[model samples]
Target chain A: MNAIAPSFPAHVQTGALSIRNLSKTYPLKGRPVPVLQGIDLDIRPGEFVSILGASGCGKSTLLRLIVGLDPDYQGQILLDGQPLNGPGLERGIVFQDHRLFPWMTLQQNIALALKNHDLGTAQKQRLVDEHIALVGLRGYEQAYPHQLSGGMAQRGAIARALVNKPKVLLLDEPFGALDALTRVRLQQELQRIWVQERCTVIMVTHDIEEALYLGDRVIVMEANPGRIGEQVQLELAHPRQRDTALLFQHKQRLLAQLVGH
Target chain B: MSPFKALTWLVSPLALLALWAAVADAALFPANLLVPPLEVWRSFADLLATGELQEHLAGSLSRLSLGFAAGALAGLAFGTAMALSDTVEAYCAPLFHTLRQIPSIALIPMLVLLLGIDETFKVVIVAKTAFFPVALATVEGIRAIPRSHFEVAAVYRLRWPTLVARIALPAAVPAIVTGVRVALTRAWVVLVACELLAADSGLGQMIEMGRQMLRIDVVMVGVAITGVIGFALDFSLRRVERRLSGWQVAGR
Candidate 1:
């Protein structure tokens, strides 16, 4: 915890996540179709891990399982050594679409995520305001989702997810629908926020460059009963430049690996 | 409105009045039967002075309010139950659909025979007219909500009340409001028709009396007033709908 505000407690080293022999299947025509098979991974606290894969690689499914959206899977998911259950405030997720309710203003949307918290009204309001400002949406609190551009709405979603101060943040192709320029800008914003917050993050995406850019470690996945194929540890530091020689090399290697398969 | 747009608004009504005046002047039909626009206007003034038009309007409006309120409330509850529960849907859907298919006018004679040609008959007819559209709208509106919304609700761990009030109801509002508007207009038309058939009061009764006495000017007054009132009802509800759904993305 960098010295910013002493009143706010430092985030404990608590988001360590471990998955062992995780498998999931869906019913199709009354027959079970395997979506994920025998997946095992570990994530350290405050680490950014990106899962890179093709469209049908079950990367999103993996995120959904970890987020506790679907509990019908076969596996053990432990958060800080505790077994997982259904969704809790300890974990937050951002989907491909912003998913903000069109009827609510941005402030109201963010405030809604704090409804379950046992905090004072003023405290919740402060948290909502801080998160909105954190995502660079301070001035547009009154704007509705439909009134916002796609990138701005996604940022609002990020604010809503973070307002709960979840120990882990899951990104399911968070910027997949964005244009190239907006995607690049939002990736940088996400990286900056991650550094400031220092929470565990698992992002699923198909963009190899993005995976290499922000992730401390990138896990490449194979489709057709999705499973881990390869892992690359990036030795680069935060506040990284896009034109770095190391990132270019990693991107080239990742492209060849994905294409060669 | 811009000056040009305001001028465009005047063109249609003005053209209509001019055509009526021209036809009357040409004596295209018997003078009494044609009923010049000025003669109709005089009859309107007489009705207003005698408070006859106000009495009829008040009676019609009160019946509309009572019937619409009862029908809409029942429809809302029933529709929600059918949408949310398979048991209710299994038992009620077929019967509801068949009943809705029969126009309210078709039931007026039978309803009059059973309930007599009184307030009960008019109110029942109006309610029947209001029920189908509202129920249909409620069912479709609630069903139209995307699955993604419920997922978000689950993720947030929203309670049942929060889910219904904050997520479900607001999401379904646009559809529900449209249904209410449709039901309201339809109910008004049916009420008038019922009044024409058997009522002792209301705008429809006024027109019926005008025809019986061969007072073409009085009949013209009733017809014009009904048109104006219907337009006003629709216009106001449309404005309300726009106000409520201002957050929707245009073209979406």
Candidate 2:
């Protein structure tokens, strides 16, 4: 554990991730198909920011770029005032699917991110155990990915992503695969975890309600040369109730904007 | 289930054996050509007592193990390399794929002519038989891994060794195990065929010797033993696969 901190400091006081004038285009056949154009956003340290847009709006693309997963972009992504070249341990991501190794148990899958860390076996086990319990998956350490339900698997994914204790955690519709009820429950859990960990989180989603419920600030993007159309600051206190008047009001407004009402 | 229905399933084999015994007793064929079940069983017992059958079985099994292990390991390495690098895939894929098209059995005649009917020829045949399926499965397996896994690995800044060990190997295990099972079965079958053709001592050679000596009972014993051994080997591998992937079953 002592050696782990020196090799890769998981926690540090850094200006969280910052994206400026970032643009991405896919080469389709021959001509470039522009996905994102001149998108600028800043996720402050310990803030929960959500980017919400309709389908094909490139919200997910922004998250990918921020996490340095797709480095074939045109603009600068900075972390702690450092230029982002590629992925780093300071940034973790959870995709739509669990992406847990099918052959590994829940414990092994969660501990995988720690493999590169200079941690001892006992310390690694402790880290895995802490994250698993944090995600409310305590007893099923030996269970494999296939043994878990969809929501549980995503929780496992969350545990794995957070195990590295990244400065920024990027999520691409992490709860989209779950049922409506499960989605709501997990949203509450995520809010709780974010408050406790104080890790900057940037999530992309199409759900208006989810964006309002989770984001400290929600950025709405428009498709066809994807760009930010509007930004909504939720100004609500932490550990917000699901059916608060403010949540409902913001949800209606965002839904109206999303559905062109 | 009805008791009579269960009884009917047992009757057919008993009836078939009775018919076979009757035919042999009636001397429908020459005594040298058609051996009774009792005679076959006696011959099997005699061989078992003398340890002849065990010696031949052990020899064949050892060859199967060696050839399959060597071939499967090489296949994994080659397949992983091909999947990882475009240069290796582009330059060697066509040639490798073309060679895989030729049936392993078809190469037996040419291999025997080149290397003679020695242990090397038989082992080589087994290795070749095991290689293609395992390699092909491994290539597909590696390709099937989702890009998301790589993204997560990259985000974690996983080192090369850690990425391969933690992400790549575990993700590819199910496919690799499938390939290994295919290789084992292929090697087992090919080794037997090779023994029948050229080996000095093996179950297949024993059957060949029986055929030459006009001992139908001994040949029948060898045939039964081969079938049982093949079934056992395949069944054991299937059990291993189940154990390794048992979490899947539990989830379902």
Candidate 3:
């Protein structure tokens, strides 16, 4: 039960996220309704952090704020010690409903992420191909979003998000819409991709097992003017086994914390 | 095209032709009014051979193209502006709605008085017909684009040009195309109607001339040609729409 920060490699000096005294309120009928309350988070480079919370706990909202999709929050969200003004190429996100442009083929869709990059055509194609293969969608490059199943579409979205080689990848309950079996499979796939990319990642989810399985540190959040409730550190190495008693123990604790007031 | 599909399209024309011939044989209403299909076909062939029908048809098609191009371009610009800018929308929306409600047919009399039944009036009427539907569709289509797409654009930090070219245009294409199709066909129909009321040359003018000369066969030929040409335009436009929207309608 060490509450200390995890040790990181000295060589890879990128993607350190810092959130300080972050609070957000949405105006509901002319009155300010607090959504996130004094939330502070610091994530190391190349770390995988999962945020778990019930609905309306500001978990997704936190991801939105972190991704710079919503810039109206009170406090600061800094990446590499610099405050973010709006969305940039350094940050990428995967939404729950795979938001692939239905008009573009899978390969074209992935290539769209590289539009702003100053890369040549061959390099862009190589990056898109590599990311498509990274998400295990090699042969289905020409397929459209509607042609692929929900799971495959989400994988394509992941490939699109990662094609830019973003420093921080934010997932807002990415596999929330999939069936349980596909969700488990994608969780493993996501872990592999995370390890390969070695980018800072923050995924928000309600699934207890998913969070504990993928996150190096699981941050549990509480609702009603959403605030961070507790943090659990899983010291296990990559390609984690779901059958571990340690994971089960953490899951039970998280469940109790979430539901037992 | 498959033989089955060809046969399927043939059914309606054949049935209508059969009914027309039967009525003509029975001398219903008068042989003069209900001209037989064979006589109408002969009239069509004679006009085709004499090159008069070709001139009128060519003139109508040229007018359609010119007027539709001008109107559709304007609609696209106006709609996109109104949608993207709140000030434009606030100032123009109510007037746009009110103008669109006044049918193009109803405006013919007033337009004749104002523009004096010339090529300008005809072209302007055709343009008016093409404008409203396209603008309405463009506005709705732009508005209905999923917010997530804009979020994706922001994440990628797409520039304004890239955003419009890639995200905005493609996203609004399906709706815009439907509107364009409606605009084009409506423009054609309204142009013909205007020509019927007043014109030097066109299929509609030919019909008016036929009525004054008591050549019901020529009028019937004009009617049939108008129907056929409209069908052809609509079918071709639909094929274009399908090709453009292949990503959505292809697999499904």
| Predicted structure with the largest TM-score when compared to the true one | 3
- The ten-residue window of minimal lDDT in model 2 chain A covers A1-10
User: Which stretches of model 2 miss by more than 4 angstroms?
Assistant: A1-12, B1-19, B249-252
- Ordering by TM-score: 3, 1, 2
Off by over 4 Å in 1: A1-11, A28-31, A235-245, B1-4, B249-252
Give model 2's share of reference contacts: 0.71
Top candidate by lDDT? 3
User: What is the alpha-carbon lDDT of model 2 when measured against the actual structure?
Assistant: 0.84
**Model 3 docking grade:** medium
TM-score of each: 0.91, 0.90, 0.94
Cand. 2 TM to true fold: 0.90
DockQ for every model comes to 0.59, 0.53, 0.71
Candidate 2 Cα deviation (angstroms), residue A255: 2.4
**Residue-pair clashes per candidate, as listed?**
0, 0, 0
**What are the per-residue Cα lDDT tens digits for candidate 2 across B120-221?**
888788888888888888788888888877776777787777776676666676787788787787788778778888889998899989999998998989
Q: Give me the runs in candidate 3 sitting further than 4 Å from their true place.
A: A1-7, B1-9, B113-116, B250-252
For residues A1-261, write the lDDT of model 3, one tens digit per residue.
245344334455899999999999999999999999999999998888999999899999998998888989899999999999899889999999999999889998999999989999999999999999999998999998999999999999999999988999999999999999999999999988887788889999999999999998999898989998899888877777898888999988888778784
DockQ rank order: 3, 1, 2
lDDT of 1 by residue, A3-72 (tens): 3232112464889999999999989999999999999999888788999999998999999999888999
